[model samples]
Target: MFRGEHIGELVGNPGPARDAFPIEADTYERLDDEFYAGRIETLTASEQDLLLATAACTYPPLETADIRQRSAKSDGNINVLMGRLTEQGVLYRVQKGQYEYTAPKFHEHLIRRTGSLPR
Candidate 1:
């Protein structure tokens, strides 16, 4: 899991700065697609539903309680599901009992795939 500080370092420091950074657009896209597919494949039906519900949230980095309510799941179920999602690299802990998607665009991706909007 990437910490906030690590993300800051990546953006703030460009090692061996150059006029133009090399961008392997195709490779990056392929890898991203594969990652998305792989994560999706590992999820159970209920897990997938929970993920979609989380994605539908307008405000993010939600607390466990918020996610549980949104998904209409019990506390214990939400805890387990969140633990699994975090392990799968689909979500990241922002702080204790708070989490957000690992990728900024992941929520949008889920929304598109599930055809679900924030309630």
Candidate 2:
């Protein structure tokens, strides 16, 4: 025969985890601005064009082929750009050969800055 144990004993106190990682309200906006600036600075002209084109679209989770058309980039180049954006957390892969902005607001930000998608 075996004895059962309380879940709390096994898991310990959950409250402590929350306490240890308390949110910092003040730094968030500053940090976000710094991060966005850094990321934009790192992109090449072609990559910036691709990102802006994708961001201008109203529909999301665009297929790789569709994005390639919109961005007017070669298939190989689009693959490379998508891989880099995915690594940077600026894009999210929704499924095989499909992706979308990591956050919709980020797309809106690009649209506001660029005023329109690239031809």
Candidate 3:
């Protein structure tokens, strides 16, 4: 038994497996400020509408149908708009389970521009 224990010690510890969880900050502030400024130039009126709509931040398992019922058209048009805003860094996705909105700047702008009460 002692010799077996020594042999096991020579080898590596065999314990439960361990996994790594990585967190990444995806801010774009490091890029030339001018570049981002130029790229984010005033959003179009249509884009603004879409942003506000998506900024509503619906969760998953809560069908897009529910979102459409609350706001503007929920057709493929809205789907495309959501994808575009997400790509622009205006939106952040939380992949744990539910889909919540993470667009503070965009949401604030929408509120100020429309002077609407929080939903």
Per-residue accuracy of model 2 over 1-119 as CA lDDT, tens digit each: 22264434536555544454445433444544765556666777877778877755655666777676677778899899888888877788898898877654565566555777533
For candidate 2, what is the TM-score?
0.59
Give the per-residue lDDT of model 1 (tens digit) for 1-119: 65666655666555554323555455445655776666777799978878878766765766776677677888888889889989988888898888888876676667666677866
Q: Tens-digit lDDT track for model 3 on 1-119?
A: 34555554544543321111111112333232333333345555655576555334443322345446556655777666556655766554454222344432444444444555444
User: What's each prediction's TM-score?
Assistant: 0.63, 0.59, 0.44
Candidate 2 residue spans exceeding 4 A from truth = 1-35, 117-119
User: What's the lDDT for all of these models?
Assistant: 0.73, 0.68, 0.46
Choose the strongest candidate by TM-score: 1
Residue 89 lDDT (model 1): 85
After superposition of all CA atoms, the RMSD between model 3 and the true structure is 13.3
Q: What lDDT score goes with residue 38 in model 3?
A: 36
Q: Model 2, 16: alpha-carbon shift in Å?
A: 41
